[model samples]
Target: MTPKEAIRLAINGRTDIGQVRDENEDHIGWYNHPSLPMGFVVIADGMGGYTGGSKASQIAVKCVTEHLETLPTSTFQACTPDQQLLVIHSKILDALNAANAGILDAKVSAPQLANMGSTIVLALVWQDKVTIAHLGDSRAYLWNKDGLCQLTSDHSLVQEMIDSGSLTVTQARSSRVRNHITRALGVTEFIEPNINTYALIQNSLLMLCSDGLTEYLDHGELEFVLSTHRPALECCYRFISEANEMGGKDNISVGIIEYTLENKVSVSQANISVPAPSSAPVEDVTVRKESRA
Candidate 1:
């Protein structure tokens, strides 16, 4: 078997009500099927008021989990690697769409939840690869010996402003419109998520989280926590605790996955340094736009 097919993964997840939030609207999930070589980790941040927001996030998690659980393992295993990736990508999109429709239907049936919405980030792992899909601002980060890098971009207005050169990163962070998101599930009839696949580096780590943790931690802080060489579950707890200590403005949810080869190679640590914010204005970053089917 190829190295890609001979990999194993360790995963752990946690969610907490921050110091300020009365109820936690963030939901996290990780599942490894007994019969398949695939697994997934998901994080969702609910929007709107407490009742609507929590319900929206819960529904999104449930729908995605059920969809993945019911996928036919035999059919997936029959495909080539490339074909398998495409199938997984399609299923991710379908699952998101299904959740969107379900949320919309719920809003229609219950007038009180009319404004409910959610941001979702998911990572699907199989063999030595990970397929990431996301909507709105929930994020995914990759960490290895090279340090940590954000794999998913935020769909928030502040992020757009920063990318377009209209606002600096420092300015965007404190902007009044920082929380305004351009894309979300359950807010409309349809949603288009950004999806990408990457080959997993042995002894590397992947983190999926809500904005709550990111709102308090910067790139350097995140790198520090992830590079501690701790167990996946410990890492999840540490991230949540640190976020809360930093003011914990929102509900925090974190999911961590550690990928390793059969031989258990060790990952080296790097002296991480934060880059200074760019002085020159940046051009607008183009996103892969999608329309409803």
Candidate 2:
């Protein structure tokens, strides 16, 4: 169990023997480091042949967790809003690169795994800051003053249709193309993931999950449930249960984060600060060429 502090988290995850497959190919993990109240939540949904799909998702979670462990602990100790965002952006990019490589390496040994890939969504919270980075269809949602806001975009064909106005939300529900994802870890040699950073105050909750959960619930439904829930963990439990009741067609994973309001602290009493950088921007190299007919 991860030692939770500022945000107490309760996690509930299950893989279903849905209408199609024999095993669920999803992986999830959550932990709070002893060095700080900050914690991380990760979920990966795999696709490919038998052994290959499972390994791809497992490798994704391991790679991300290992990369986070190597970062300087000071990054999470507490800092100005800008500094926190910089640290998060840099670290997330590094982890995604590593996870991509891990999947590719696995493919080299087993050629059948060449197309093995997984969708990943990872969220980190340290004090009042929240950061999310994702690839593929896994998502993150926040229940706050503005209501439920989806923080990650789906990288699937159905999502593209919705974005392009070719399909309405109702049409997407039954679209055979709903499962076609545009991106994944080992499907290609390189991947550029989306990273998001935001600030959180009191009365905020975050939901990190795979499509198994979101595919069944609308934004308004989730908001009302999460807002009225008890422990953060129970919220996760209910979400999964509801999804299963509707149709547990895939693996389910969820991570919840609830921020407790901290008393207002004066600037002088804050524990950390970020100093401005002193170096100037570096210039890019260029070469000129002339052509003659």
Among these predictions, the greatest TM-score belongs to 1
lDDT of 2 at 87: 73
TM-score, each model?
0.88, 0.81
By summed lDDT, the worst window of 10 consecutive residues in model 2 runs over 284-293
Model 1 Cα shift for residue 50 (angstroms): 1.9
* Deviating ranges (above 4 Å) for candidate 1: 264-293
The weakest ten consecutive residues by lDDT in model 1 span 268-277
Report the lDDT tens digits of candidate 2 across residue range 1-293.
Answer: 11234344333444444444567788887766564557778889888968777899999999888877655465444565557567777777777777888888888988978778999988887655667788888888777665677777787898878878999878887899888999777777667677756656445677888888877887667877887787655787888888888878777777776655544432221332221111111111221111111
Clashing pairs in 2: none
Separately for all candidates shown, the number of backbone clashes (residues 3 or more apart, or on different chains) is 0, 0
Give residue 178's lDDT in candidate 2 (0 to 100). Answer: 85
